[model samples]
Target: MKSAKAKATNYKACLALEVPAYVAFYKAPPEFLGDDALTIEVKYQGGRTEIQKITVKVSAPGGQQKI
Candidate 1:
């Protein structure tokens, strides 16, 4: 069995993608969802609005991870 500290460390290393808007939608039926998987609206440098979608998969860590 893993030690308590080791388990805590392992969980800390794991990263989860959290999108407040998509949380509720993800729980809903797929038919009601839109084409965009995960979208984040941000204001660019010059007061321009832009929408960006990031595709991510939840998986166990084997090697290095991206931020």
Candidate 2:
């Protein structure tokens, strides 16, 4: 994504626990392949911000794995 922004949503889980949650759906670039680096910025409801780095792995279709 060229530029993306996200907002955290508050959810009430079991036992009356309040938690911040986020859900994202994205489509990778058509020309993208192999391993790529993804950076995400998380903003909580308490005005807390965090930077997270994650790895995005892409592989060929029907690729076989050696035991």
lDDT of 2 at 44: 75
- Model 1 lDDT per residue over 18-60, tens place: 3333222233244442333466677666899988776534334
Each prediction's Cα lDDT score? 0.43, 0.60
Which pairs clash (backbone N, Cα, C closer than 3 Å) in model 2? none
Q: What ranges in model 1 sit over 4 Å off?
A: 1-36, 45-47, 61-67
- What are the root-mean-square deviations of the candidates from the true structure over C-alphas? 13.1, 7.7
True-vs-predicted CA distance for residue 59, candidate 2, Å = 0.5
Query: For each predicted model, how many residue pairs clash, with residues at least 3 apart or on different chains?
Result: 0, 0
Scored by lDDT, model 1 comes in at: 0.43
